[model samples]
Target: MKMAARTKARHESLGLSLEDVVQMYRVMLQTRMIGERMMQLNRMGKAMFVGVADGHEAAEVGSAWCIRKGVDWCVPYYRDVGVALVLGQTAKDQFLGVFAKATDPNSGGRQIVNQFSDVKAKMLSGSVHIATQFPHAVGLALAAKIRKQDHIVVTYGGEGATSPGDFHEAMNFAAVHELPVVFVIENNQYAISTPVKLQMAVANVADRAAAYGMPGVIADGTDVLDVYEKTKQACDRARGGDGPTLVEVKCYRYRPHSSDDDDSRYRSKDELQAWLQKDPIDKAAAYLLQQAVAASRLEDMRQEIAADIEAAITAAENDPDPDPATLTRYVYGEDAE
Candidate 1:
């Protein structure tokens, strides 16, 4: 479906130039393409398991765009491929990780697929355990505060993570300490097979933010501009020493929880179809067209990104696997070399 008519005034009000909007759309498109390719690889049995950020591009890209890469820190969850891409992780880098190649930058084939990390980008490696990154983010923020640094930390997780004790502990500590951090909950309406209704009694995940003494803001995750604007405000507040803010982006994931999941067992096909109608990439493209970006230009952008992803996959497939002798290298101090 087409998004509301895009106006120059709207993006301008958000301090975004037309070119900036175009670039944002490009990132969203690139994110979707990469996820799709990963799923294909998983289906071909080239990758053991995969998680696609099929419907989370806008939320991930928009919020990530607000951070100063290499200065501010990002502690993202597993489904934040768009965040990693925005923070300077290349498509080849991601492909290498998924292919479990020796040169994989995140962990040299040690970590699971999609557990993204880039040292130069200041993005921490994600843990397999849910809500663990919340405390990690708060710790990073605490360090920044002690150092009198201007940078802030941003952490992301699904709504299911909010139900964990670590999430609550991190939020309370960050709030009490007035730490510079932003807690981003990408509420995709489901936690594996469990829907949000079963996860919490609250109407929204942001609603719980007030209990921790921070402002809670909700944004349309399908709208890149809205996500960018709200996340930017929260980031600015944290950078200005106003402490943490909980920003909840309402989104829907088109794919199953993982390659191993069978979504049909929990959600109905009609429901999936309904969410597909509001695909974030389509919404972004519609806005671009309304901004007078030629349709051909959008198609060409897709083609370019598709070719790039194909090249990345091919290169990653050809890359060598980790040697058996190095299995205990990073796991042991003396064997690291």
Candidate 2:
């Protein structure tokens, strides 16, 4: 793809109907609230780790929903808060993971690994390492192929991971083997303090896919419908055995990269304010109202979501912590007892 292609292909809206946008509004808001609440958990002494996805909702939710859930796998990164929730990680499960409480979806309090999974849902674990899941997702796609399954794999990342060797190797090998894997990059313009322009020479991450002999396109990631439209095409391409695709989703991060790292240290106040002005949730909600969704209904929905989130927090707080000794149970490979 040409360097200017992603930018050129983008900026044109795909004309997603208001109904589709309405359907996804609740999930988007919930994910944003969840991300914000997780920060509260951190400050309140419940969570030890939190990777908020304040700005990456559209990319995650749209990508996850576009795929044939459970028929395809999603290897999400740490910041994939919306995608994880869309993949069925209930509020309680996520907060439970933060609380290290029993009954957490992934482990029932036994493991602190991926938050949730159901082969039927096709949602895999969201890893913490930048591009580590790239290879693992390829392995999963390889298994699906060897078994003659039709399932595809979706590997997501931020623009930062594009610089890693794992991203290159995974794309190269997936192309060579003709594996079913779609690489999605949520290019939020910045990798923490490092701006994306400084991270790579290419104008857009999607343009770099040509080196791997794959189609690379950019999506208006802030626009959920655009994200959905682009990702749906990529999913179709992978399912048809056309091989991998690179989708660069242009977005912005409204908050710090993580709890321990504050953007104020490196980013100026004006930049942060600029991004916040384009908040995805507000955009979706506004579109919903414009679509004629009842204002009362919207308010009720918000209240319901708040109630549910609060309940999840309470459950996470009330649930007992994992046994201190059991940390070693799921840590190592099964022993030859």
Candidate 3:
């Protein structure tokens, strides 16, 4: 089926094929589905914890889709399931991580489910301390520059992390050295239980980019295409040796901080329902259907993805836990030769 005139024009302007856009929507859908299923598993006591990725799929998927996977580096935070998936991580990999199975590629079940790293994908694992990834990302970018490589690093964190000291240091270092890195602040309007209004004095997180002498851009995280366009521009600038760009994507969080927190204490049901009306998955599905993509075709895609998720869950469940004997292997360094 042919794309709608408007859709085709937009993709053409961005130099993206219709198939590429469809793939973006597909990844977003899969990410959302994986989060939902993970939550169900948490409720069923299959997993220890879960973080919801419902509202941030567009921001995560759109930004990651712009990168060259293994060619570029990604330092994603705890809620970046969509980013990990786009960076060559399979649903089985995610499930294994969540299940804390010995087969978990990131940490062999030692770290949290979201702390993902793939050496082959050039994606770094995140830490519990917020904003720590910024410094690591800056280091990666600095190394690439020293080696005269064309690689760029894409790092993600919440607006709340911007308050930390490391955030400033990383930004300053990147700007001073003209490091090729893109900092994405996924401002989901809440830092766990604290609302954005309570977290900082500034309105937009991107506003702080001025202090570090870098360009700042704001985009609607709910609009996948808009995000893709903005991120692509930032990455291109970095590749051209123009230094880092701070992108603040305004979005909403549909779930609580984690499987443990109660969101109703700080947020009203009405507010969440309002954001649900603008859900990225729903928006993309509607747009595709309008472009002559049949509803049956979309449903088939959903079914296929659901089956893939289930298969991952089954494989992870069958996998064993990390052996106790190997518990301290990675925790501490061994004696040097």
Candidate 4:
């Protein structure tokens, strides 16, 4: 197998070794497979709901790869399965949340599916409200700065979240205080059924970053290496006391917004097909192939991932539901009783 001259040159320029790119492809693949399985479970009535990161894997995984998992913090939105995975959440962990099992670390079955949390991983539990995690990320960054910690915080949201006051407030505060945080907007071009054009007049979400006094970058969301390079620069700047950056990754979701939404009324089939041609997973696979990774190897990787997902589903199904007796355990203070 011969590596393409362009592929070799591109990765080398990014300072990533061949092994690093391969591992990144693995994470992206795993993220896609996990999301697909979750959606399948939703259709089977085994899971209540699912918000997939089908086309946003590169953005999530690439940005997450720049963070030091346990040291740095990730305040992810609900649709950040790839971020959670890269930050140390496993297939089993995601399945636990999807099934709302007692072992579900995020909320112990209290919260909705895809609301990821892991204290050990420094991933803040996400909420149902859009852009709410922005303030939380800012708070964490503030704490890190005050404590003289070297760690930075990376927070994620959709482009539509940029319309929220929370997003502005957090960005403003972070910039004013020179907090170490990176704001990543996975702009899939739609906020559920609402197109990006209806949400904002600006051409790109990153265009708003200048108002907050931070660098704004637009990365190709379908290209893992491009996303990694852009996010790495932002993370490096934040860690170096250069304040925050607003990165808008241009991507598209292949699926409907969620299990409940119908995208057909809002999006044309042609538009969907056009985006599908640039599928992040397929792009990464092609890159791998050009880099001498065998097709059989990719197929075997998929099989292994599928088997792991099956095991996770079985474990999650057999796990007990949260006990009714302990329903109020984490909800209320003991003094309140």
Candidate 5:
């Protein structure tokens, strides 16, 4: 009965026209494919680990789409591959980071993939410590304010990270200063073995925004339209000097937290089955097909993306690995020991 009930509520892609639907559909599909490819590499022993953004694509893409890459700053987390890629990362750079090859875009194979450093893109490097990105985001927004620039900073994290004090302090700081930042929590329901209910008291993460005196919104993370609308509204307000917004995106994770986790120990098969039925990429694809996107055009998009992924994998696999000789080259800047 639960399976039937959950399956029956498969997400309906929201948007007015077919073009907008197809654009979002492509992004969702690409994100899923990237996660899938990373998983394959992990299994092949080519990569040490993989962070799948399988279920959080909608929120990621929606957030990226609303901001200008060159002007805005992004404090991304480890699970932000899809969002970063969509915003401006190349396939080779992303794959190279996973492979730790010398050809990696950001680190040149030195730093981990998550420590994404790019100045022109204005992407603040990521940290392994959860919730750290929040404060960094606040700092960046404060800097932008001091510089009198129009750039806004957007940071992302999970509902589980919200349990930490950093999240609270960052939100409070952003609000107090009226910083141009958007705090987005991709509530994927499960943070490793713990579920959302165990992590917090409220049903929605955005509800806490009131304490900071800012607008808060809850969006359907499975539907790109919902995320896009909410993100644009927040960025617009922030740009207008209305302070920050807290967005709680309600989404599900089809896979475990990382490749190492086995969600079965904590979550029941029934729950997984329920969320699996509403896969955002598949639902969005179905919406595009329903909207009369030419079958040939859809096939072309698939072929193009597949070729792109395959090329990236192949290149990164053969690329030169990072040299051990210079392991301590950048340990303390150019002049430090």
Candidate 6:
């Protein structure tokens, strides 16, 4: 098999090896498959809820790839399961949270699904509220700067989150202090049922970064390499003490906001189909194929991922639920009692 000239050239220009992009594609695929399985579990009553990253996998994985798992910090939102996975939180780990099993590290079955956390990976625990993690990431970045450490911080949220005051506060503080933070907005066109048109008056969420005295970038979230390149640039700038960057990755949500939302009420079938055509997993696979990856090889990879997910599901299901007696363990201090 011969690599496509264009694909090879693009990767070379970005200073990325073929293997790096291929691994990124694998993580993206893993995220997509896991999200799909979670949705299926929800429908089957095996799980309570799922906030999938189907159409936004590239943005999640690619941006996550830019951060050093154990060095830089990741402040992910509830929908950023892909970022968590890429940061070393396995499918089993996520399933434990989804199933509210005792082994779940994020909350021990206390928090909602997809609120990923891993101290070793430097991934901060996420919340269900929009834009709350923005200030948290900014705070971490400030700490790193004060300590004169090389650590940087990466945070993610949706387009709708940009409307929140938390977002502006974080952006303003990071810019003013020149904190080492990168803000990634996965703009999927809708905030639950509210379209981008109604969410904000700005044409591009990235444009708001200029007002905060930082660079604003718009990247194609459906293209993994494009996202990787843009994110790498942002990470580099942040590490250089050039201040934060607001990156708006244009993406779409292929499913309803969650297992509970009825997307049909807001989105048209035609619009959904159009976005499906641009699915990030499909786009990444096509690029790999163009790079001389065999179709059979891709199929084999898919099978391996499927088996991994199945194993995770089994493990999570077999794991015991949190001990009811310990319900207030993390909630209250012993002195309070």
Model 3, span 54-102: residue lDDT tens: 8999999988988996799999999999998898889999999889999
Candidate 5 lDDT over residue span 1-337, tens digit each: 3555432221233323566567667777777888888888889898887778888888888777777879999887777776777677777777888999876767778776556777767888767788999999999999988999989988888888898899889989999999999988898988788888888888788888898888889988887777888887898888988889998888987777888888888989898778878777776767677666687887888888889999988988899987889677656668533
Residue 265, model 3: Cα distance from true site in angstroms: 0.5
> Which pairs of residues collide in model 3?
none
Worst 10 residues of 4 by lDDT: 3-12
TM-score of each: 0.96, 0.89, 0.95, 0.95, 0.91, 0.95
lDDT of 1 by residue, 1-337 (tens): 9898865567899998989989888888898899888998899988999998989999999999999988999999999999999999889999999999999999999999988877898999878999999999999999999999988999999999999999999999999999999999999999999999999999999999899999999989988999999999999999899999999999999999999999999999999889889888899888889878899999999899999999999999999999989898766556323
For model 1, what is the C-alpha lDDT against the true structure? 0.93
Task: List runs of model 2 lying over 4 Å from the truth.
Answer: 1-20, 107-120, 332-337
Q: After superposition, how far is residue 136 of candidate 6 from its true place, in Å?
A: 0.6
Task: Give every collision pair in model 1.
Answer: none
- Answer with 1 or 2, whichever has the higher lDDT: 1
Candidate 4 lDDT tens digits, 241-291 = 989999999999988999998999899999989988998889989998988
What are the per-model C-alpha RMSD values against the true structure?
3.5, 6.3, 2.7, 2.8, 6.1, 2.8
**Candidate 3 ranges beyond 4 A from true positions:** 1-8, 332-337
What are the per-residue Cα lDDT tens digits for candidate 2 across 237-333? 8898888888889988777887778787777889868877877777777767765678897789889989999998987889887777777775567
What lDDT, from 0 to 1, does candidate 4 have?
0.90
Flag the better candidate by lDDT, 2 or 5: 5
Could you tell me how far off, in angstroms, the CA of residue 294 lies in candidate 1 after the best superposition? 1.1
Supply the TM-score for candidate 3.
0.95
